[model samples]
Target: MKYFYYLLFALLLCGCQETKKEKISRLVNEWENKEILFPKNSFFTIFAKDTIAFDTVDCDYKVFTYIDSTGCTSCKLQLLKWKGVIAKFDSLTHNNTAFLFYFHPKSAKEIAYILKRDNFNYPVCIDDADSINKLNQFSDEMMFQTFLLDKENKVLAIGNPVHNPKIEKLYLKLAMGESYTDKPILSQTKISVDKEMINLGTFDWQKKQQVAFTIRNEGDQLLVINGVTTSCGCVSTEYNHEPVQKGKNLKIQVSYKADHAEHFDKTITIYCNVPSSPVKLRIKGDARK
Candidate 1:
């Protein structure tokens, strides 16, 4: 009887423990269609340069991103990359999308310098006390802190489009309306990589390691690579931007530099015109001192 009771307790514990996928599903259900509140009394600026007025146009959609005073500020902000994304979005949507950035800075001077250095002139809010995050109770993960909100400030989607190509596509589709299609019909190419995962084994932390992956075009259509993104600042990638002909292969060079001696697992995402628009590749290894 005692053994049966112990077994039942163990089974109950296993059932109570949620998997990563289940947790993500719960978070999505919680935030979906939820209205986001903005602090009306908060001040706005063009990156500390000048005071700016906040306006919500009736037909406009908003992309709100928040950065807390954790980790590398400049890396998390990526203001230069954001500048290009905003420019493209404005050009395509005819300035119908509003990008609202709220930062909880560890140092005001550092934030100011980053804005100036990146030449980011977009309007931003400095939530010194983290008022925005406090109200929203946003996810701790940086990737989930950004959201796409409709005219009514209700969340249409959650996730950073810049980091995830699928999220980017979803944002464009939601904002551009039903009839809008960005990719060409001939761009529906099929692609396959030589290896989806690579193990670098043990290496010195200070030493840089590089590896290449071969991507073959398996479809009749031309394979156009839109972009390649890395999960960490320490990891970088290089690849040809030109289209890949059918039955041809493109080499993607990935380099990793460890910030400290530790075990690391990082991902590289390839954004292309294939049915699976964003293909993910992972690299893992132990870094020794």
Candidate 2:
């Protein structure tokens, strides 16, 4: 009778251990795969121990915490200073604007605590445990991946973080309304233009007309206009000088010769620093005899 009781007790203990292990495994799995969304239409910032800092239009800074494990001890969490811009992108929260951050056990613990403490009210993501473990093995190195998506979750910009300095500049560019590409850093500067769009009314195709466009350097730094080009040979442009200084204006005289004129439309692209992307000017009119 005593032997039967002992066997039953052993079975119960074994079953309890198995159940406990399974429960722990499930929790860990969920933590690894958890996906939390930021507060919709809300703005928040993210800071890191490394480079990168984000501020909203109001210029509010973000705070973060870090965790480190010592030997066989539990993790320890410490608050970090505000570093870079990891803010919410109001209407720009499409997949293209979303950024992913991979963290290790220590970093993950700190991140998890932040997520829970903040009620998961921001646009940040925590990596899975498998990725965390891999990062742990490669502690001396850092890696990151950024994806830019359109409204339908289509990726527009895909950048792999390797070097620190290069990534820092890339983040700044994205923050300032530029899309990421595999191309090198072409230019960075400031410029002043009368308007983003130009409208030239109707003109006789048999006559020639000249219009003046001004380019200024409103920024604190020097502005460089490398060159200008038009779609057709009928149009020509001349600049004031090579490099335009701050607070100075360069006159771009555009002369259009009304030869073989019908409904005329042309686009001119000015490659410069103020607007790092591209500047387009339009000229349109009806050619009358």
Candidate 3:
């Protein structure tokens, strides 16, 4: 009986382990400076103005993410927004930013049809089967998955490329070899919040409830936000990593998903050096089935 109990406990622990997708999701706004595996592949075609091979391109600041169009319409729309966001950056930006789209089609004809129909004016890779399978390992439907990786391939940010303009600026700062600091070391401090509660309105059962508010430091001291944690695992929060100077601002985006159609009312506690200390942020909304 003792041995059986121990085995059962081990099995329970194994079942509770977070999957790869969850691990990746947690990397949002973290600059771990880790390298991601870029497999060599021969099944890719580019429709951009310049005929560049996938393997030859650099990965200094690659947008390493997948866009599985086989999902819902909103996801497809977000993908389109990403494409537009990438297009805004000129060739000069391309030197550092590589929009790595991962696609795995079962048939060559399907691939041809997609390419011919979409006429995507950017680089696309026919990701290896192993990579495709690894992504599919995630149980949830992949929607507008985007990971902003630094030169070392560490995660810098996640979500749509244009989701946050400041993120793009932060990427430029890193690419230019400048450390991100909101204000001078000596003169940095105050806590200013634009809103305490943000109404997300309504989200479809398939959609995640997301909203953001501006956080500013209104005093002459450096405000260091150590972390922003939600009430539960289904709620994911992201914010800037750099110091918040007296004059500068940072946006905190909060998103949550549920297993059923119901009302969501959650709070995210923000831990920072400011006098506000731990600000209790709230989010309320209705998610329809």
lDDT of each: 0.77, 0.42, 0.55
Question: Which residue pairs show collisions in model 2?
Answer: 52-84, 53-83, 53-84, 53-85, 54-84, 54-85, 95-149, 96-148, 96-149, 191-274
Q: In model 2, where do residues sit more than 4 Å from their true spots?
A: 1-187
Report per-prediction Cα RMSD to one decimal: 9.8, 27.0, 12.1
Task: Give the per-residue lDDT digits (tens) of candidate 3, residues 1-289.
Answer: 1222222221222123457445434433232333455554434457422346565346466776664535322223234445555665435465667766666544435544445445555666655364753733422334225555666665554443343343444445555555654332343357778999877778786787777878878887777876564554356678889987668889998877764676767777676665444567888888887
Per-residue accuracy of model 1 over 61-93 as CA lDDT, tens digit each: 999999999977765786756786788788887
Lowest lDDT sum, 10 consecutive residues, model 3, at 6-15
Candidate 2 vs. truth: CA RMSD? 27.0
Best by lDDT: 1
Q: Which parts of model 3 are misplaced by more than 4 Å?
A: 1-26, 29-31, 47-52, 56-59, 77-80, 91-94, 104-118, 128-144, 179-289
Model 1 residue 275 lDDT score: 65
Residue 237, candidate 3: alpha-carbon lDDT: 74
Q: Assess candidate 3 and give its TM-score to the true structure.
A: 0.42
Best by TM-score: 1
* Ten contiguous residues with the weakest lDDT in model 2: 73-82
